[model samples]
Target: MAQVLEFKLPDLGEGLTEAEIVRWLVQVGDVVTVDQPVVEVETAKAMVEVPCPYGGVVTARYGEEGSELPVGAPLLTVAVGEPSAEPEGSGNVLVGYGTQAPAARRRRVRSAPAGTAAGTGPADRTAAPRNGHAVQPAAAPATAHARVTAPAAARPQATAPAPAEGPVPVISPLVRKLARDNGLDLRQLAGSGPDGLILRADVEGALLTGTAPARTAEETVVRTPVAPAAGDGTRIPLKGVRGAVADKLSRSRREIPDATCWVDADATELMRARAAMNAAGGPKISVLAMLARICTAALARFPELNSYVDTEAREVVRLDHVHLGFAAQTERGLVVPVVRDAHARDTESLTAEFARLTESARGGTLTPGELTGGTFTLNNYGVFGVDGSTPIINHPEAAMLGVGRIVPRPWVHEGELAVRQVVQLSLTFDHRVCDGGTAGGFLRYVADCVEQPAVLLRTM
Candidate 1:
């Protein structure tokens, strides 16, 4: 007996919705195993290699390469036992979830040339104008039916006269800037340079004509105030992570009625722990790592905060596992890479994971997986020496905690006033799932853990 299965595009994390097929690794008539990478999909940020979740003989391919397909749409059909046409409604397989459809095969076309004008057909030189005549183009030099002609040898003729010397080369902008600063007349300076090109040495020679050392542009000290240009000031187009962050933050603000709870903490012990840990040095972990660790621990203590408010269902599903997303600043913009199941890991593991995520993020190596599945988030503004800031929650995550810088501040210690390293924690939660008391307590738990680093072990 022969059976067939179809593979469809899976929900590629986040609300990706759709993806463009970059390339197909397997083709019809090829045998493939379950979980083997069969196709490469290009999303907005990366080209993710998606694996086949069902083992079968590929029978038909439904979509061609370079086509955009929605999640849950059939990609290809495979014969699990026998080949057959796709069944109604059931052929739409979810990657890791269903059967592939019989895809149509077509050679993928290259992307359209950027800025190509619509309605303008491919250029035809045959109809072009030349010398007041509509000239039909001469046949291209090499073709199968074209005649091959060889030129006759040149007669023993007189040698042609030598070519005249061309015009002198002009000075470059940098060279001119250098010359002006050096007070050298560019014209009077006969270039000792080849092809009359002015070299920096030539400019220096002109300046050195008098006393005191002559200076070339490189050696000159000249400063000029830059004038404002005619257009409106710098216009920055919002796109990529920065644009995504703005959109998300706006949505979170509008949809989720958010409330914040703040807590002050003595970061002396936390700072000491960080220094000691860095001394042992595997991955030089920082205060942010410790803060992320504390945030995860606090979320574990309060599962209510680890849930998203389902407005449609009118319910909050508290997650059983921890997927903690941390805010990272990169040259591209802000990104949050999640540490999946963070509650299962110890401080060392968590620190290593956080370091890995941040390094990958900064290097722009983060896969869509690392950017999604976050049930909670932590954003550290402490690096900028701020006391606290209310970071917007990464949408779909219930809450986000902001960690501020650790600085020495006066506080009553025992009976007398003393300087203590203090940092602030700002917790912003979805008001629908968390009340002020719950939110406050959850923040207080994190603050307590940071205040006493040893308490984290017990909490974990």
Candidate 2:
């Protein structure tokens, strides 16, 4: 009997309510093994490959690529050993949890902590058991603390003193391969590791110490940028992150009824505040920092705006804490890295976190959690000096705020025309969820906060 098992999309990580289907690695009717990457999902930040939990043939794909699916929604149907009509729990397992099976016959067993079960997959390899029989695995490497070792009965004594911290571990596999192939002395060089791990710096250091070959003049030549041929418009393929962005933007424009409202305000005070903060600096702060802080405070006053619409439930899921996501333009595409509990953070912490988030996003090192669960989004078009532009609403969220360029403009001050730094604000909302009144109020609140920088401190 060929059983049909419906595999629902599992929760990728913390606060990830939904994911955008980036690509399908396997087509329908394709045989997939347990832990094989069956699909790729893009959650605001990075694209992650989702593996199959069970070995079976893919019966049907429930959702198409480029579709935004909620967590626990049916992703695909797999034919295991039973028919599709089988009940949910007769033998089937839920998403994230493995398949249901009878309890293992216990001999004399020991216990393991949570998330300690070793995964039997190519992504993670566990050392074979010394007992010569396949048994429960020990020391799963999911966590950083996990170490591969022989059975507890047989252990070796530690001999070497662990290497001290500093730049030495940051060397990439490619760099290591290059060094080995070229017979470079890695130990002779100083490292430029994250915390000072031995990286290319150490390799260069070896050359300085006469332990490695010095680069030839030909190898040190800098290449100049070439002008493209006339009428040859370069068409970059929108694949991976860029492709995903296009799909989402198209979907948002096509599906959501976006209502955009614009406001012009004096940004002289906000600009001054940013200048003062930059002068006093720890991390180099920008106008984006002030906008983020203002948005955090404003969301509190207009909680209805800081929410996502659940279409299935036809209810507005208002988030209690503000997780403000910023639209950062990266080489890959636009990535929205969520600042978890933005309301709880101070100016300094928020600035630092923003820097970390942008760094991680650009470096392609953001964790699953950092990209998920954004209540609201802020896009700074001001950097490019746009007066106002209608921004696409990030799906699920009711609205997205766009900040336009702040330039000196003539305005009335005490019955006299005066020049002041002014910027236009654009707020686009999903009309189905948020009414005109709610949207207007939210924009007004945000504009007020930005216009009066002191309101942020008072609100906090």
Q: Against the correct fold, how does model 1 do in TM-score?
A: 0.54
| TM-score for candidate 2, residues paired by index | 0.52
Which numbered prediction scores highest in TM-score against the true structure?
A: 1
Query: lDDT value for candidate 1?
Result: 0.64
lDDT of 1 by residue, 355-388 (tens): 8888888876578777878899888887776787
lDDT score of model 2? Answer: 0.64
Model 2 C-alpha lDDT per residue in residues 1-460, reported as the tens digit of each score: 4444545566665444556777899987799876677887776447676766667777656556765555655566565653232223324333332333211112233454466653222212223223432122244435432332221112222233225544334346745764554455454444433233443434434434455644345433421123122123543434445756787789888877889998888788888888887788577676776788888777777777888777788787888988888888887688788999888887778888889998988876566567667888989877775788999988768788999888899987668999988889889988877688888887887777767788777776
